[model samples]
Target: MQQQRSLQAFISRPLLVPALLFVLAVGLRLVYVFVTSTQNFLEGDAGRYFTMVEQLLTDQIYGYGSEKSNARVTPGFPLFAYSIYSIFPFTPNVFRWVHILIGAATVFPVYSYVSSVSRPLLGWLAGLFVAVYPPFIYMTNLFLTETLFIFLLTLFFASWQWMMNKPSVWSVILNAAVLSWAILTRPGMLPILMIAVLFLLFTRPARRLLIPYLLTVGVCFLPWTLRNWIILDEFTLLASDSGNALLSGAYPFFQENPDYKEMYSLGMSQTQYGVRVILKGFKEHFLQYLSWFSFGKLYYMFKSMWVSSTLNFPQLYMYGGVLLHYLTLLLSLISVPYLLIKKNFLAFAFTGMLLFQLLFIPTARYGAPFILLMVLLICSAAYTFWINRSRKPNYKLPAGSAS
Candidate 1:
């Protein structure tokens, strides 16, 4: 009864708004998961990812090169997929189920961290936002490494901040591991390179803390990098996929079966031809990149974060989430000063997170939508939670307490 009473007391604390919001987030996400991922596993990236993992285990093929019969993601997804696959060998659907569970579980850490910054209600609101967002929910059904990578990224970031506030070697090591794992899964982080490392090294009074973090993550990456070098022959730091993706995104000719007005290479399929033509096309289309990074593009990209994929397609309509995104971004903007003045470095760190996504995978595919949506979700939750506290009236003064 004592522990139960204590728990109830904790729950009843004035900030239970976040708690309620968290539950709502979970409920929304659960509905999404059931709608999308359950019993229906089909083609596209999700199927490709699951099959790639099955290939890794059944055949010795590490890199699923585009040789008419294979597919490729960064090594991280397939390797992690294999781990998930081993547990439920009978069905790829099992991993799909696991993806939904893991993706749904992301709400907790996301809520807790954002909640820590402001209120538990804010955390819950953030969680609720994530719970319902389609980009997150859509990805949950596939075997993408992004699912695990993001969850750990959120977890490590929260823990890293907690450790920085409190200071501990274990926290440092865990942060390093999480980030390194993120890098290993998707080498796009290789572009951002050492932001996290530099943060650990030079940001603190206890400069000694940097040693364990760098050393731990370094130890982890050494073998991984060495293995890459041995296999891919170049100074392969992480994966061998980005070159192909960049080629595909930069030029329209790289589509699955091009117009064939211009053949870039002989004996190469449409995909391979695109990858081969990427460099030349980039040189020719250099102006397109400038347009991509322009103020207009950035604004549109940021705005797109809140809008539904359905908006682009016109077949599916759900605009309520879009309204929620607008509110979210406004609140997040409000919190910017708080994060800066209050020494919430995660706010700044998250800027780098956005930048990392921007610099590498600027495409509007599954990767690009994540950035704006995340901001919108976090901000909207803050606004909703904030309004409830400020505007809502309560008259529950205790026995001896004065209003």
Candidate 2:
């Protein structure tokens, strides 16, 4: 058929080999690092995360000796760390390796996601972007839950697409599992699951499947809530730290250089102090929330560009990289209209989720949802250009004759 020949020509183009090489080059660079950087400990988050897990196993409390309730942080990640600490190697070195190993699962899902949209090849770029992405690797090596979150989220995302293609009980159950797990990791994720469920309710095929989806999600959360209530003397659903998050986001406005440590020195318990800050922001500094939507996310995403540069080091090259990162992100924002016109519902929804999190907490870490926004946009551009080139007729050739 004409379509089959066209598809073949697209795949066999002169640049196909180079594009494949670019992806492989990126993967090999990231994959071989475990052997190369054997001594590099987790650069961030991994330290605090593992320490919390250590407390859970030995101190019989999540925070161990610290007066601060670990519940102020999300619980799912520490629980995962402890689970791994119990059965697997307890050394930080082994933990780093484990995180790296587990992160490998992201490759397949990222590939499948791009394939679902239009082309399987685009998935390579997306997945490779995640692998070499420095923050993700750093998060994994330490005690953070981003990798597990990504893995779980990819399943939920893929399931969402699958259900769109063919609504079935199996897809609903799969989505529920992924959603519940994602919720456990990032509290913000509960909203995302709600959106997905709502999407199902509104869609033609999934509307009938809402009840079963709800029941499955309920089953997942009940056990965790019950455990917390029995052991922690709280009727907490997952963790008891929303008050602290609210405070952390708000307290910076009351002072020039507000620090979490200052709250402790001032004798405010973590949860108590944090709650007051959140309330204070709402009552007095409500404008910060709106300001953050426009500038805070822009600033944080601006900073996230540079993996090495900081206000501390300020290396010229690193600073340059940092600026480049946000510049690309800004381009992504402009392309939103183009994507929307193309009916890229999945990318739009994903960006919407990030937008929600940014509204509440606009930090570089919180901006993780925009993982490959720039890369995908550029790759899609390349593919579009290639397809256009492939469609051009040979004007110099004889009419009605093949080139």
Candidate 3:
């Protein structure tokens, strides 16, 4: 009896819960990694990133080839992977394990964010959801930006949530640094950060801290921009992938296959070609595309669960991810009323990012980061419902209301 009581006491420590969650998260990621590591194969952007890392290590350049430099993809992930490979031997397996740790570490931010505003139960739920989240787990084994981008995004928002209330210069600088790294990892985050700037300006405490935040994010781009100009002779800010991404979205063939031709080949720059293709496609199929494929794109962003062709798991693996994603979306919708009541416009930053992808080229992989925020909102709503239920007065009905 004494041992049982002591065990309970040990388990009930304030730090034990998150620590256990972190351990469980890491364990689950390792299980998935072990199961799928044999099937690890790089293709498309994954292949590009792999080559970029090699180039980074050998030539000290951030591109694909020995002689020429390409800025199509941002250097953040490659740079990060290169830094890792620098310390360790060059092995993709080791890199994947590092990513597994990264994906697992995201639980910390999720727990921190949820605990800041809601009950510990909700925090545990958020952490657990992220721990076993199928998409997050799967992305770790593949060499892609999604895993790192998701981790940075969760950390950024976790800090942003607290900074909104505290408004410390240090916090602003930290989040701005995270935001810059996020953009470097996935350039799509640039516009999302812009939306954040606007959202912060409206908040009382955050408004006073906007200048340093904006300046930090702005300055973070200069070094990359300079690199782009010196190497590619292009005044690129985030990356050269933006125009290609837009082109891919506008190209109808891109739906079925990634190898699509540029419809507009008038020697336009990447930016010009992207704009021309999108405008041209919209001019031809404005209503039909907008009414049908646009919604389809949005649905794909939220619903599809494309892990990898090499996944040897059962069909349930894919379907399970879709089911959880759909359920979370529903919960997020249900939570909207609560968010509105609380006047938490931080949601705008996430929604704007989602809508931006929906408008252009959204994939299941791209939606991974958004799921972190969705998990928080869903757990928050669940906790709110639980609290209200517990608080409901146990009023006795008059004599015979409904015996």
Candidate 4:
């Protein structure tokens, strides 16, 4: 009986659910990794990242080659790869395994963020959703920035929630630090930081720590900006790829026009040329540009899971995954008004992020990081529904008098 009670106690521990979710997450990802072990990792953007890591190792440079260091891409992922390659042999399987671990560990923050705001059971559900999400598992197989960026992004949300709840100096600093790393991982995330700063300025409990938060962010960003300014002779805050991103999005359906290429061939800076193309496109095709910016980009962003070409899966699974993606998005959108009515700050920040992505090229890969957030919102809505239903008084006809 004592042994039985001890087992029950262990089972009832607060962390047991998240721990089991983490194990399940790791197991699922491991199965996928081993099955796809023979697949090539150096595909698409992975090749560019691999090349950057190679340059960092042998040439001690961060750019494409030894010619000159450029800020086209941020150093976070390459540095992450470099740290791994420094210890282990540069092999695809090793990197994938490490990424699998990093990807699986994201479950904790998802659980923490959800559990803090709602019940623990909903938190477990959110973590499970992340554990089995198809695109998140597939992302670990590629040597791209998505895995690391997603992990950091979730951690940022978790830390932000923690600071809001407790309002400690250390938590404030930690939130700022996570935000800095997130921006460095994906320069597009810079706007989210601005949104956060604006939110904090208005929030009472967190307003006092805003200066420390900004100072910490500035401290974290200083070295990278200084490096870009010194080596590339440009004051690139995060990266120099925004121009290409703008140009890519300037066209409807991302199809480049001949005039865009002609303008680029005239030796104009990419940023300037991209701006000109956008202005011209807006002037020439106002309605088309408006639709593309508002709804078209949103449709493409959440349409499908970004699967690896080499990893073959059943068509049923792909269809089901896409169906689930749409369902989650729909449910999350339905929950937004509820969240706003309750004055949820995180909801505003997340909505701001979704809106901010409209300014760039639309790709499902960009939406992968927010899968956890969508799951959290869905679980929150579900939990609220369950609670409301349970609280309702049961009504029945007395003595079956009704017909």
- The lDDT for every candidate, in the order shown, is 0.58, 0.62, 0.74, 0.80
TM-score of each: 0.72, 0.72, 0.86, 0.89
lDDT over C-alpha atoms for residue 112 of model 4: 88
The segments of candidate 2 whose C-alpha lies over 4 angstroms from its true place after superposition are 1-45, 58-70, 251-289, 306-328, 338-348, 359-361, 373-403
RMSD of 2: 7.0
- lDDT tens digits, residues 1-403, model 3? 9999998898567557777877887887787777644545476668877887887788887775333687777767888888899999888788878987888888888888888778766788788888776777778778888889988888887888777767788889988999899889877777768777887788665677889988998888788888889878889776766766665565553554333344334656655766676666679988756653466676766765546552544567656667787888777877866765755654666666766776567677776777777887777666767877899999887986887
Q: Please name the candidate that would achieve the greatest lDDT relative to the true structure.
A: 4
Q: Model 1 over residues 288-340: C-alpha lDDT tens digits? A: 65554343234544565422245331233256555655665566666555554
Native-to-model Cα distance after best TM-score fit, residue 371 in candidate 2, in Å: 2.7
lDDT of 1 at 295: 38
Candidate 2: give the clashing pairs: 46-142, 46-143, 306-322
Which candidate number maximizes TM-score? 4
Sequence-dependent TM-score of model 3: 0.86
RMSD of 4: 3.5
Model 2: which ten-residue window has the lowest total lDDT?
Answer: 305-314
Worst 10 residues of 3 by lDDT: 256-265
Instruction: Give me candidate 1's TM-score against the actual structure.
Output: 0.72
Compared with the true structure, what per-residue lDDT tens digits does model 2 show for residues 1-403?
9999998887766445335544553454355344333323545556666666776787767662254454456556777778778897678766666666667666666666555654666766566666655555445544467668877777677677786787788888887877887888887676676666667767776688889889998998887777667766677776665654445555342244346687878888656775566566667877875565556655664456423323322256345545556655766765565665554545556656766565343566666545554555544544555676789986586688876
- Two-way lDDT contest, 1 vs 2, winner: 2
